[model samples]
Target: MENTVLIKNATVLPFTRQANGSLNLEPQIADVLIEGDRIAQVAPAIESAPPSASVIDAANHLLIPGFVNAHAHSMEILEKGNHEASPLELWMLYTYPPLQSQHLDARLCYLRTLIGAMEMVKYGGTTIQDDLLELPYVTPEIFDAVAQAYVDVGMRVSLSLHTINQPLHHTVPYLSDFLPADVKQDLEAAQGLSDDAWVDLFRQVYQKWQGYRGLVTTVLAPSASQRVTPDLMHRIATLSEEYDVPIHTHLLETKTQAITGPELYGESVVAYAKRHGILTHRTAIAHGVWLSTQDIELIAEAGATVIHNVVSNHRLCSGIAPIRELMDAGVNIALGSDGMSSNDSFNLFDVIKAAGLVHSAMDTSYDRYPKAADILKWATYGGARSALLHNEIGAIAPGMKADLVLYDLNTLSFTPRYQLPIHLVYAENGSSIRKVFINGQLVVDQGRVLTVNEADIVAELQDRLPEYAVHRKQILQQAERIRPAVEKMLSTAVSQSLSIHRFSRPLHYVS
Candidate 1:
């Protein structure tokens, strides 16, 4: 007996690629038939449906494929709105402080991940590439808890043990020179596992948690190029090749980081990764904001993906990514909310709108600005490619996974809608999302989640906040001790010359 659900009389937006390599989206009133976990049919009319099939009337509704969040960090879910606009380097010290002593309980990890997962699913996000990292190091229990949250909520997740093997001073340029002897000693004492131990940690977690629910899978995340050793990168590459999984890593996201490649590796980070076999079609680079023209070429040549975190970039003052250049160079672009602490939300609708508008300043010609259709494509198809699920997900068509979002046409966002794709990019904010289905299962309906108890999770999070606040203050206190020195490092790096600049204005003349 096959399970089936038939959604009737909805305006279906099926994405089709044209001969020119652009997406063709045609919205037609149709019925979508889901057989088990896959879409069986999408047509103007379905004359026959199984007697036991469930049916929903979707008149005046717009059906589209759910958004794929190509890159994110579930670990930062609890840190939302805790900081103001700051440089990435300075912001990281507080959010990911090295001197932290406590580890989050596994149950707390589950609850925190659920909070983000619930927000994502409610807001039309069906898939996430979560580069989840735990401070100090990741453990099997913590990894399982996070993975289980996504499974329990019925959303697809590509989970990675996001880690950095290199010492703190080695990752950021000029950090050792700026660090006081006492601070340096404390950081060295707090250093995490060795390279080989981190590899074993990944293997232990991957073997147990991979394919847990056919929706949760593991990825190789080495944190960043400058933050990892050649040995670790090679090991990650080997594992990636052996499993055919995606590699999610951060690249140059800020001006300070832009100087890191030439400062540390004598080349761009992309070239460094290529030398280590880490740059491949399966590689998905998060935040290539400071990549050079040559770096972009190398990424394109290797068939790698660069996820554009537009909202986070602006929030952290990281600078705009060369999305137009990347697209022109044949690099696939995807969108990411980045982290809760940075973007402050899990809504891809916000990311979509921001991504559509942020690139206009990149060029004077309007023709070069991002198209609403292209932005939607990046959020869906490009993200699926980044997640290594291009063949299985990212489209609303026969043989695609039954992950879909139905937006109410009567909502204010669509009330006299001129163009639906445009509204989805420029106007919509997930408020009109009436129903969301993942893997043929209805997880969100009429602004409510069906899979988990949001109330309970919210209550638990609130209950733990007092204690959490204490730890946060302590972390901030520790970070404040090094704030002066870190600011100096940032100023020094940004003041240095680079082949390209991503800032809105020339940084050299700032003072």
Candidate 2:
């Protein structure tokens, strides 16, 4: 027998936009019927349901689609606060080096993923893109463990085996070179592992966990264009085409990357992608902070999606993405919190707030600013579209998956709320999350996760924090010790390059 649930007396914020630019925020005092794994119906009130049906009274709550976090690195959840103040390159150098050492074992990685999943679910994010970047210890067991953690927590996830072809490269060219020699060499060796090995690993993982009970899916992530060689990119793209799955990559996130793109490839990064025919609807580029106007148009024409990690960009000092320009160019835009290490939080609502504020600041036109509803759509529908799960999830309409979040409007944040969407975006935070349902299953109810013991999870991760702290302190100390040497090396290199440029200037100046 199929399970059914009916949520009654809630203000339904459909989050669906109309033909006109205005949002359809008509507060519907309706009953949302969930039959099996999809929304059965949305009506003013259902007279009766099956006797065994579960009924939830949502008298003072707001029912909306669950938030879809389009990009995240769940493995970095444990490394959050330690690297918060450092610049992007320095932080990566200081933090990620330890993971390549003995710090990140399978057990620790799984625990981090579990904790990350819990944080995301607690904050009303039903779906997330787990961009698990290449770990030397990454194995089929690690993939299964991560997937199992998500399933155990009842969160929808798109798991990507984050791949990089040149893992040993220092500083990614545009970024500072801070990687230690040993760490760089180890990563390079890992990257040299045959593509056939990765394919075999992915095939095993996909067969074991893809679409596991309809909550988990597999995605091909090539890490970033700069990190992977052109041949590897082509192979990954071809693999994605063959598997009929989505591909995720980081693209044009910084000015440095934009400057380096032409040097790496004969053309711009987007142009190179276009040449390889990898700029398809199945591709989603994260960040895209420095894409050109032409690049935006190309993405739109190619039907690709851009996931704007506004909070991560600000935290890392990466400039704000031209989201307004991309939207105007008909490019699909979605929102992501990035890694916990970058943004320092997995809360999707926080990300929405960041997006609204940053875009509003950029445009300087209040009327043209990204509205709450616009971000709401991006969080749900645009996210699903990015993951190529548009038909399965996103909205609260009938036939869509029963992925919904209930926000308690009885809280002080929503006091005397004139407009629901505005209150949701500006005032409310994760504390307002009353319940969440994914795939017709009640994952969180009354501000707690139902599938896992929150106290136990927290306690377990807390106990492991001491060991992580040792590693954290060791890495930071090592980085601080080596910092002077690395800085001197960079300074010498810069001076030599400048001298060459100065000496090479034309001697016969007609002017």
Give the count of colliding residue pairs in each prediction: 0, 0
How would you encode candidate 1's per-residue C-alpha lDDT over 273-362 as one tens digit per residue? 899889999999999998888988999999999999999999888888999889999999999999998999999988999998888877
The TM-score measured for candidate 1 stands at: 0.97
Expressed as tens digits, the lDDT of each residue in 1-511 for candidate 2 is 8989989998898765578633466678889999999998898888777888899999888998888999998877887775554334445657555235442666777778888888888888999988877454357777877888899998999999877656534324522355566645544454334677887777888888888999989998876776667787788888888888889988877554565566557566887776765678899999988788778888999899999898888777566788888878878889999988888888998888888777766535778887888888788888988898888888778889999999888789899888888887888888989889999999988787899998988888888888878877766765564455444443333333211111112222111
Superposed model 2: Cα runs more than 4 Å off: 17-23, 98-103, 174-192, 470-511
Residue range with the least summed lDDT across 10 consecutive positions in model 2: 498-507
Enumerate residue pairs that collide in model 1: none
lDDT of each: 0.88, 0.77
lDDT of prediction 2: 0.77
Worst 10 residues of 1 by lDDT: 502-511
* Global lDDT of model 1: 0.88
